[model samples]
Target: MAIEAQAPPPSATGPAVWLRKHFFATWYDTVFSLVFAVLIYLALKAFIGWAFVDAIWRVENKDLCTHDAGACWAVIESRGRLILFGLYPYEEQWRSTLACLAVIITIALSCLPSFWSIRRLPILWIAGFATFVLLMRGGFAGLELVTSEQWGGLSLTIFIFSAVFVIGMPLAVLFALARRSSLPVIAKSFGFFIDIVRSLPLLALLFAAAVVVPLLVPDWLQGNKLMRVVIAFAIFFAAYQAEIIRAGLQSISQGQEEAVAALGMPYWSLVIDILLPQAFRNTLPSTINQAVITFKETSIVTIIGFFEVMASGNAAIGSGEWGNQYVEVYVFLALIYFVFVFGLSRYGAWLETRMRLGHA
Candidate 1:
């Protein structure tokens, strides 16, 4: 006698299946999930009510804000300019705004894959930086020249970030190569140099450059406070980045280099054409990580009297009128930081994907 064939198990689909699998897979899971769902809903509702429903938005109505329960967003509306531009001259603030946009556009253009080549990248960066400096400094085209001391707010932050990255990246590559030198003396010396710099706190380094170096160096050598700080920051960034790059170099198989050498390629060609490319591709993520850290560290310059974004925020709240709105200013500052950092991370991920696909 033939037995009836068994049917395959039925498939679950859509929201009901998802709920059963995740929330009701076990009794404890079901209970916890329901409890969490209620808590999340209540929290979200409360936040929405405070942040939007009861929030005041008019600058003129800022006095209406009480110490009761609602968020005082009107403070932000009234004082947003001061938060963004700080002690930047009100009439010249438009120049700062345009300069900031120029820097942002430059950063965006640099991140695109199309400008990745050596010829294009240098030209793009130089032109971009020139425009940024020209617009901000304003010595050309009949515009008044603004000194570094006069620079403040988001413009200062952007300037520091760009200058540090541009200078630090090449220095990092050089340091990494030197650290990996075949000669023991050179490698050891480079390693010690990197270690010494890396061991020092960024604040100490910035302090030394901003204050100590001036007393020791010649008159002309002692540049603007901003330049000194940027140089110090670049040194600090390079030290950390060099180690990351050397680690990437170490990750590559010796056989690949050996094979290239056996093919009669010159040492410089082997390094430039094969080794450096592979090492950089391998270390792109780490490089981006270092960059993000450096970008955040720019806020430290405010301690040395440079009015970066953090300083601007402080100025925004320090004013007696909006003294209680420090939290709002900080939240806005955080959003700006998030935008830059998030964009950098996304670009890094894109570069990694491209490298993996052999596009780099």
Candidate 2:
């Protein structure tokens, strides 16, 4: 008697199959996963209890916090303005709000494919930055003058990051090209300069820009302290970004450059159309990482006495009235950072996807 061969089992799919494959592949895997799952559940439960179940929310009242075992979010409720706007006058904070919104809108628009052109991007950024400054400074159109010194908190942080990127990117491109110059002198000089800037600590650069530059420059030459710090930050950003762009440029095949050269395009056309675009495409991730870094580094301005968001957060909790609520204040600050940084990272990921699909 001949027996018929049995068919192989049907291929698995769905949630149960996925779970068993990944989390319960073996007895050890199942045990470890169960432990971690329980740990995560406990952590979430504790966070929910502290953040919502026992938290206080009423504004301008600290009395409720003295007896509370949960997070004293009342501190945030009371001092949210100080954290958001810092030393900016309470009455004029409406301007700061609009200014912050301007920068955010500009950034959002810049991320879109429609505004990615060199001409369009430059125009959009100019308008956006002008609006931010006009609203924050407010010297014209019957608005009261608020000097740069008075600019602080989130608006200042946004301005610093935007200005640094706007200024530094072009500067970085120029440095990258100069470092790759046909002449050894030009290449070596830019390379040396880039290395020197990269070698120095950012804090030291800011200190020299803030404290030492004043003694060296004439009174007429010493512009706003904020502007000086921004310039220094931009230079430091340029050095690193220059190297990133250079690496991108170097990654291109020599055959592509030769082909482009044979096409008899002007040098600028070759760079603007043929080379830089591909370079940026190659280094998109690194460029995005650099931008995120520059944004967070704005907090370093506080060390030089500029009250960006981190400094503002400190001010929120330093007033003794809400001193015990430091955790809540820091958490709140972290959430603000998380919003911007996460959004940036998501945007970067989107761009990468677009580029891969050739939609960029």
Candidate 3:
């Protein structure tokens, strides 16, 4: 007791201290960290060298990139128009550009908290979609009318994805409600219908919509292959989304509904005012995941002869001039998809954080 006091251990804080504790805390961790650090450095060095230092960036210098070890980004520089607009008339491609911008702006607006209300959301989307269609179709004002067949590339992909989601969400709510109805017959019937749709492959459903539906439906009812396929895609999306909503509904307490009923609230009012909102909040993550999947699945329309963005990329690389640069085209296409998908993921995370804070 009469000796000296020992110094306190050094605090394991700050950047260097924290890094040492986390990455080199033990022998195995230190070894693993060193190994991975070497691998990452090598990868980054090679990627930077190939993608920037040696890459071809100019359209006129594309020939120099042929058979070279570096990336051929010049293909993108040259064929960007073809990749973006596809078969849309060259002069009228301006309309396609406007339509694409409209949809993109609509999507961006929808992500904002201020536009989260049901009334505001619907009005925003409807006006945005209407503007998109009017500009693309161009039957009004002094613009020429372009049919659905003429629509392709990124604009077509966005249109199909948005149409499917907008149409499917309401149908999914109906299906979920029907499946949970008190009436035995209605519940059983909807359950069976959902089963039937869910059991079939999406490809088969689209094929039937594109090829078989016209034979059975009336002339005016058939509309166009694009419409028919969109309806079918919506149904497919609804079948899965319905189950998600139903699960959300089931997660709600029986007492919550009973309490609302005891207050003399009408069934529709109780559902719309309390139950549906809570259910959607509970299932937001799953809903966002389904939306992402549906957006990616829009590419399947290409099989039925619709030239969406994926098909446009394929066509961009199919030519003799850029045939060897399929990798470049595909990489560009991946970047496009990553933009939308990553945005969706970040929006979902933001929604979850905001809702959690609200509940807290």
lDDT of 2 by residue, 147-195 (tens): 8888888889888999999999999999999999999999999999999
RMSD of candidates 1 onward, in order: 2.7, 2.6, 2.8
* Candidate 2, lDDT over the whole model: 0.92
| lDDT of predicted model 1 | 0.86
Measured against the true structure, the TM-scores of the candidates, in listed sequence, are 0.93, 0.96, 0.95
lDDT of 3 by residue, 35-71 (tens): 9999999999988888888899998887698676688
Cα deviation of 186 in candidate 1 (Å)?
1.5
- Candidate 1, residue 96: Cα displacement in angstroms equals 1.1
Please give the TM-score that candidate 2 achieves against the real structure: 0.96
What is candidate 1's lDDT per residue for 3-92, written digit by digit as tens?
Answer: 999988888689998989989899999899999999999999987887788877787878877766467787778767766776677788
Poorest 10 consecutive residues by lDDT, candidate 1: 63-72
The whole-model lDDT of each prediction reads 0.86, 0.92, 0.92
Poorest lDDT segment (10 consecutive residues) of candidate 3: 60-69
